[model samples]
Target: MITHPKPQELTEAVARWIEEIRPSLDPRNAFLARVAANALAAVTRELTMGEQAQAAAVERLEALLGHGGTYAALNWELCEELRAGQMDTATPGLLMALRANVLDQLAIDQPTYRHEAS
Candidate 1:
């Protein structure tokens, strides 16, 4: 039996390829290649970390929204609540949950991003 490359593995490979050749390209092309590599890395992170991040987000949404459902559904409800002024920092766990969810997304989208806590 043969094992196929995992989605994350493919993304990582592509990212590595881009990084390896980025320096040999023209200045503009090198910049683009770096951007492409960053995108591929984010894709890899999503494949590797999205599930756990989503589950944690779902849990936070459930507690904050007071109900359970699919990640999309719960997230929508949470957004609506926040927009309707039903949730705020005064709401217990709201700030922490939001911060964690955002941080998780940043972990995938921009691992080098820095966050300063208030």
Candidate 2:
């Protein structure tokens, strides 16, 4: 039987390849290669963590909104409600949910950001 690399694994591998060759590139191309590698790393992080983050977001949304919907829909509803003052820090789980969601996003976009002092 044959095995294939997962999407995250593929992205990470490509990123590694890009890094290994980057020093041989011209300055401009090296910069672009670094950008490409960073993008790939971000994609790999997303592919690895997105599902669990999404599920946590959905669970938090349900607890906050008391209803079920797609992540987009629930997220939109949360935004709308916040904008309308239908939800706020005083609302149970609202702050925690929002914090968790944002942290999850940061984990995908820039894991180091979360580790640094804020």
Candidate 3:
């Protein structure tokens, strides 16, 4: 089971990764450096809130599907699509992992937050 990451942990990890990558940057590449840092920060933010966001997504999907099922029963392609957000700049591998964790949790909890269809 993947426990949710604390916001502070995500921030600190991202900061450390940035610092580790900083020394490789040239003065002429500062713009690129900032962009990379920003991307990392965005990923970190997503990680911190990933569980809640994914739970909400699942709820939305259940409503859309008009039925309930284990996360295992969800369309794998749907899960994959949500895992890979349409961002151009950075690889969202970590975000995908987070999404997977949330799905696993949802499977265990058998969460049902969908509205009844009229």
Candidate 4:
């Protein structure tokens, strides 16, 4: 049996290739290559961490909302509730859940980013 590269591996390889070639590129192309590499790195992170992050988000949302749901459904419901003033910073567990969800997403999207809380 043959094994294929995982999606994360493929993204990492491409990102590495972009970095290897970036120094040889013209300034504009180098900048573009950097952007591409950054995007690929984000993709790799998402492929590796997205499921766990999503599951955790769902769990947090479920506990906060006191119900079970798919992430999208729960996320939408959360947004609706917030918009309608049904939930807010005053809501128990709301701020903590939102903070956790944002931090998890930042781990995938911008691992190097430093926030005030960090």
**Estimated TM-score per prediction?**
0.90, 0.86, 0.42, 0.96
Ranking by lDDT: 4, 2, 1, 3
Question: Clashing residue pairs in candidate 3, if any?
Answer: none
Off by over 4 Å in 2: 1-3, 114-118
Ranking by TM-score: 4, 1, 2, 3
Error of 2 at 117 (Å): 5.2
Give the alpha carbon lDDT tens digit for every residue of 16-118 in model 2: 9999999999999999999999999999999888999999989999888889999999989989998999887898887888888889899999887745545
lDDT of 3 by residue, 1-118 (tens): 3447666466667777776787788875766776666666655656556567666656655554457765446556445655676322243353454455555444434344343421
Candidate 3 C-alpha error for residue 115, in Å: 28
lDDT of 1 by residue, 1-118 (tens): 2238888888889899888888799999999999899899889999889999999989888888888899999888888888999887798988888988998888989988766762
Which is the winner by TM-score between candidate 2 and candidate 3?
Answer: 2
Report the C-alpha lDDT of model 4 over 7-64, residue by residue, as the tens digit. 7888899999999989999999999999999999999999889999999999999998
Best by lDDT: 4
Question: Once superposed on the true structure, which residue ranges of model 1 sit more than 4 Å away at CA?
Answer: 1-3
lDDT of 3 at 22: 74
True lDDT of residue 74, candidate 3: 51
| Candidate that would win on TM-score | 4
Model 3 scores worst on lDDT over the 10 consecutive residues at 109-118
Off by over 4 Å in 4: 1-3
